[model samples]
Each structure stands twice: as C-alpha cells, then as structure tokens.
Target chain A: MSASLPYAVHETAGHDNASMTTVGFWIYLMSDCLIFAVLFATFGVLVHSTAGGPDGKGLFELPFVLGETMLLLVSSFTFGAGMLSAQAGRKKQLLAWLAVTFVLGLAFIAMELHEFSTLIHEGAGPSKSAFLSSFFTLVGTHGLHVTCGLAWLIVMAHQVVRFGLDGIALRRLACLSLFWHFLDLIWICVFTFVYLREFL
Target chain B: MKAPLPHSGMEHAESHAHGNLKSYVVGFVLSLVLTIASFGTVMTDLVPHASRLATIVILCVVQLFVQLVYFLHMGTAKSQRQNTAIFACTSLLIVIVVAGSLWVMHNANVNMMPMSMSIQSALKHP
Candidate 1:
C-alpha cells in the first residue's frame, strides 16, 4: 500500500522519478521482515535444543533487558517527535530530536553489545548450543539493523543540515521514520518470544 | 468503499501520514503498560505457567496493534488500499514461514529418530 521514495542518486539523470521511493522502501522493509521471520522460525524450532548448556532463563537479566527495551521504546517516541518537527518545518527542533534519538539508539545498541559480550565471556556463546546459535542469529541480526539505522540517522541529519528539508530530505526522513519504528515493532517480538519466554 | 487506488493519492497518504502528538502519547503509554504487564505476568506468581505463555502472547499481539495504530499511523494508511493489501499478504507469509517451519521440522524430528527402540516406546517418547 505504498509507492515511491526520494529520487535515488543513481537513477538515470532525467529519471529522477521521486514518486516510487517511499513505496519501494516499504517493499524493502517487508523483505527485511521476511528475513527476520526465518530467523525467528529457526529460534522457535531450536529453542529447546540447549544440548545441556545454559538456556535463556539463567542467562538473561530481566531488569537489564527491560532497561534496554525502554531505551528503544523512548527512542522510537523521540524519532516520532523528530518526524513531527520535520512535518512542521522546524528544522532545528527536528535536529534536536534526532540527536536525542541518536543517543538513545546508541545506548540501546551498547546495552545489546554488552549483553552479547557477557554471554560470550561466560562460555555461553552462540557456539555453545543450538539454542544459543539461534538466539545469537535472531538477536544479533536485530542489533545489526539498529546499527545500520543509527548510521542512516547520522547521514540523514547531515543531509538535512546541508540541503535543508528539501524534497530529498523529507523523503529520506519519512523512510528513516519507518525504519526506526519498524525496529521497535520487531523488538516487541524479540522481547516477547525471546526474553520474556525465559520465564515461561 | 473501493476504487482504483491511484498512485499519487497513495504517496500523499503515506507522505502525510505521521499521526500527531496525542496519538504518539497514547501509543507510547499503551505500549509501556502492555510491556510491564507482560513482565509482571511472568515474574509475579499470579498466573500459572500453563496460562502464563498464552497471556503474554495475547498481550504482545495487542501491544503490536496499539503501536501499529498509534505509532506507525496504520489508521491513516488505510486509504492506501493496495499497500494495506500487500501488508496483509506479507503478514500471511510471516505466519507461514514461522508456523510452517516449526510444524514441518517438529514432525520430521520425531519421525527421523533412530529405530533401535521398540515402536511403542519410540511413539510414546516422541
């Protein structure tokens, strides 16, 4: 139910058809969604395959992960605020919001990296069991997306500074909004089926 | 209720999408409430293990819809009928990819086990 994105830089010079960029980006997000779906399926199938290793229950810290979740949730809200400021043509406010969002996003990634490192340190690394393997694949992949998103946020903020909120900036902003919020959506599943399920 | 979902109209629908502050507040608050409730459901001894899983799953789905409406502006995007339809198809594929793989792999795991044990024992165990 979407179309067009900001004109791509590589499109033939005259073929700067800006109309399809957003929709095309939507399709790209859906395809990424499918990739997550497969990883999630792998996790579900092998969730019990711990092979005598430490499973999720003993490995996860609920409060710490909750802190991480809240960070991402608030970052999402901040990004939404950035989008609103952009919509109202308040470029400075938008940039401020983006800065808040970038820090929060960075914090979330830091916590995730910390979590992964701690696990690896304890000899509970991905190679420890099938469960760990699937766990790392699914959660690491999400972490990877957040990293790319933060990079995009940086580039977009720079573009906004240089170009103002021109057609290209607005289009890119809209896509980044989707990308950021979409990560939050995926995290809901991760927290539910991955983290919270340890208690289950 | 139906029409030739024009492309420009679709772009305008998506481009102008982001719902305002009130919606964002509602989505944010509702999401936190749902998330806390999910954690509480597991940590507190209030619910039995059997029902705990189901309860959290339900809460997760509800929170998802809450975010979709308030955060992603799905309500606004409804005007983009084709996009919505494509989204529906994508959701279907997600269900199949996840559920379908689990089902196939599970049965295969059971059936493909070594046959050294008695058939009755194997069947009972699997």
Candidate 2:
C-alpha cells in the first residue's frame, strides 16, 4: 500500500506531504541507529584490548562525564521547548530556546574535545591500543553527530526567522527535534555503556 | 506577522511537531532521576557493587522508553505503529549483531589467548 494512504483521511493537516516525509525520515534514523549498533558492538569486542595502555577504569572520569551528560540532557529539553514554541507559533521563543540548546551542545563538544586532547597528551591516544581505538571511534562518532546537529539547529533557526512557523519550517524543525532527542538517547547509551561500566 | 501555523489546521500536526509541555517536563524529570540513580549507584558502592552494572543497564533501558514516549512520541498510536515496528526490528538486529560478535570473540579469546600466552612463557623460559 502507498504510504500516503494512511493519512488520506486527515488531509487538513497537509500531512499528505509531511507524513510520508516523517516516515521516510524515521527510516533514515533507524538506519543510522544500526550504524551505531555496529560501532557499539566493535567497542564491546575490543573493550579488553588495552595492549598495556590505559583502560576505561583508569581513564574515564565519571564526574566529568556526568557534567557532560547534564549539558546534553538539558539541551535536549531546551530543544523540546523550542519545538513547543514553534507549535504555538511563537517564533521568538523558539529561536531563544534553540540558541540556548546550541550553547549547551557547544559546551558539551568543547568538554569532549578537551577530554580527548588530555587523553592524547597522557599518551592514551586511540592508536595506543585497540580498546582506545574503539573508544575513540564510538564516542567520537557520537560527538560528530552532535556537531552536525548543532549546525542543523543554527540553520533551522535561520529558517524560522525568515519563514516563521510555515509548513516547511515546522516539518523541518520536527525532524530536527527527533534528531536532537535521538542524539541524547545515544548519549545515554554511551555514558552507561562506556563510562559507568568502567566502575565494574 | 504571527499566525498559528497556517496551512495545517490539525491537532495531530501540532502534537507531532511539538508534544505538550507536560510530557516534556515529565520526561525530563524522569530522565534526570534515572541518570542520577545510575551515577549514584556506581559512585556510592551501593547495590552490593557486583550488580551495579545490571542496575545501570536496567535504568538506562527505562530512560530510553521514557524519552521515546515523551520526547520522540513513539507509542502504540496509529501514527507511531510504523515507527515502533521499525525500532523493534532494529533492536533485534542490534542484539544479534552485538551479542553474536561478543560471543564469537569471547570464545576465540578463550581458545586462542592461552596458546599465545604459553608461547610467550616458553620463549621467556627457554
């Protein structure tokens, strides 16, 4: 059956176009999730291969990770708030919340980069061991996604300023909302699997 | 300059674009609690220490559901059934791929590391 058939009854929402886009986007996200799953599996397989370099137990600072987690979690909430403002047709509040979220995300990336650089300075660079390699790859990939998300947020804010809550703007923001929250979801997994497990 | 999202006069569209504030606040609070609980369990040497990892994984799963429902708005709703199906399938694949690799690698390590270790020791001694 055509994807468009499902929303035929509710054409008033103009979801005739948006529903298909949303579903297509969801499928894309699921594919991206699979990529993460593969990376996570690689990390699991190589977790013990420190090759005389530092392991997670010696390297991960939970308190620092917790701080980063707080920033990301708060940013996710602020983006949610921004989406709400967009729904209410309040473009100014939407932009404000997006800006707040962007700053929080930026701070997270800065802390992450600092953490990486510090690790390299300590000679625990990814090339030092298999464990470090997987760690950097998985965490670095997530960081890169957040970086792209920050850029997307900036673009969406520019779009909102120009177009207000028009159909296209709203739909794009909705997609970005899903994406931003998805990144937070991935971070939860990262901190749990990569950081907290170090305590064990 | 301001109109309530012209061209889509539907409640579902609004909810889809932006869930209500109550859900957002509730999800945020629940996620916050879950994160802290996981952190505290690890830091405080509580939960008998050995099961801390299990507890954290469980809490992480719960938090995932909380965010999925409230923030991403995935649920049994007709609109989300496809999303749910897709997620369920991906989860199955993730389990297979991750668990399969771990199982194979663990066995390989069990079978191979000792021979290498013995070789190293033999070389060291003779």
Q: Write the per-residue lDDT of candidate 2 for residues A11-54, one digit (tens) a residue.
A: 46434667667878988888889899999999999998887678
Q: Model 1, residue A35: what's the lDDT?
A: 98
Question: What DockQ do the predictions score, one after another?
Answer: 0.40, 0.54
lDDT by residue (tens digit), candidate 1, A1-200: 12132332333322233435656777888899999999999999999888779999999999998899999999999999998888767899999999999999999999999999999999999999999999999999999999999999999999999978766788789889888998999999999999999897
C-alpha lDDT of candidate 1 relative to the true structure = 0.83
lDDT measured at residue A145 in model 2 versus the true structure, 0 to 100:
99
For candidate 1, give fnat to 2 decimals.
0.62
What TM-scores do the predictions have?
0.86, 0.90
Residue A3 in model 2: shift from native, Å?
24
Interface RMSD of each: 5.2, 2.5
